[model samples]
Target: MIFLAIATCSGSAFAYRPFDGTDAAVAEPGELEVELQPAGVQQEQGTRTLIAPWTVLNFGLSEEWEAVFEGRGETPLVPSGPTELMMGGAFLKHVVVPGSLQGKDGPSVATEFGVLLPDSTGDSGVGASWAGIVSQRWDWGTIHFNAETALTRDHHADVFVGTIIEGPSKWKVRPVAEFFYEKEFGLEETVSGLVGLIWQVSDKLSFDVAFRHALTNRHPVNEVRAGLTFAVPLRFEGAHNR
Candidate 1:
């Protein structure tokens, strides 16, 4: 069997568990949310890539702003190669037109921008990216749309568009699906789909599992992912006085 440790891996800064797209929402001020994947597997062309314990940290900067950090550790299952740290980045997300996602009326809107860091191997270079998100919730379900562009590690321009659909929010356990198309200018194009389930255990915690299949330039890639997300509140005693 093949093993991998990559979490919600994507070309941009905002892809979260079970989905390659993110909602138009930000954490509440002084709150922290952690997204973790203990193990994930991806297989392509008779080779397997294993990344263990992918992680993303989100910290609330204000009512409408958040700070994000993402990274991962990749290792060969047989130790054929040295372990490396990859997919590192720092980002900022802002809620622009808060509506349904923020408990208001219409669709919520947000944007994220960041710099992508190089991995330990240095085969990739530093790059930049930005994404826009829109989300709407109905009595039956919720939908999120995302559009993003990035200057890749190889210095190529990459563009991605994705959509996510989730079952009724009232359900403790809900079915989720994501579909996306991405293109790396002068390179390959990818079409991908994912199906998954999310269990909302409590107000502050959730778990998810998903399976994804993608066709890149007619080559197939398959992946399995499982992870959890939890929130914590941060307190600053004298913050109001500042």
Candidate 2:
């Protein structure tokens, strides 16, 4: 079964959406973005529902450099032996576009490369993961394309491609959509889409709300996600004089 919902509100362009899930679409250097997501679902075999909380933080180091940290762990409604914990990974991104790219009128393009450290419970000691991103921005919206490859301990390589779109709106009410494809893994080959909104409060602060639903269920654990995101700006003073 497929489900969908839409919510509209009056405000700025940054008011309604999840800004931290997609690393490639985060803010530029010297900026800070944060997200918190709480989701609930019922497993195929389990009669009781489960709730999980996820958090993400992104920081811009320089015009061409950024860092991301994420974590997720959930306690089952019913007490299990140990609450399952999903180890999130930490990664760094380097932008390949010139400073002039930000001032362009039409669709501006940028490239990014990132590395994911081994930090998962299922594959805690897995090898490093790599990803590449291409992003384009226009007056009406922004598009982000990302390709990621993971090297596991068993020498298996998994690859995935994801795309996200943010529509232009006043009062931060931007709608979002995403699709993903993966190969060479048990959880291989699935596509998903989401619609949500963003609210921009000030130049340095913003809030986001989003809804995510899977179009297909390749595994037994398909889910729908509702999340909230927050972004805080980090400013450095008097760096030009040094």
Highest lDDT among the candidates is held by which one? 1
The residue pairs found clashing in candidate 1 are 4-40, 4-50, 4-51, 5-51, 5-52
Q: Write the per-residue lDDT of candidate 1 for residues 73-140, one digit (tens) a residue.
A: 76665435676776667889999999997889999999999988776676888888999999999989
**C-alpha lDDT values of all predictions:** 0.83, 0.50
The total number of steric clashes, by the backbone 3 Å criterion, in model 1 comes to 5
- Native-vs-model 2 lDDT? 0.50
For candidate 2, write residues 62-138 as lDDT tens digits.
76666765555554654353445443355566655542235544333334333333332455443445666666666
TM-score of each: 0.91, 0.69
What candidate 2 gets wrong by more than 4 Å, as runs, is 1-31, 38-51, 78-81, 98-101, 105-123, 153-155, 169-171, 215-217, 220-222, 233-242
Give me the candidate number with maximum TM-score. 1
Name the lDDT of candidate 1.
0.83
| Residue 12, candidate 2: C-alpha displacement in angstroms | 30
TM-score of 2: 0.69
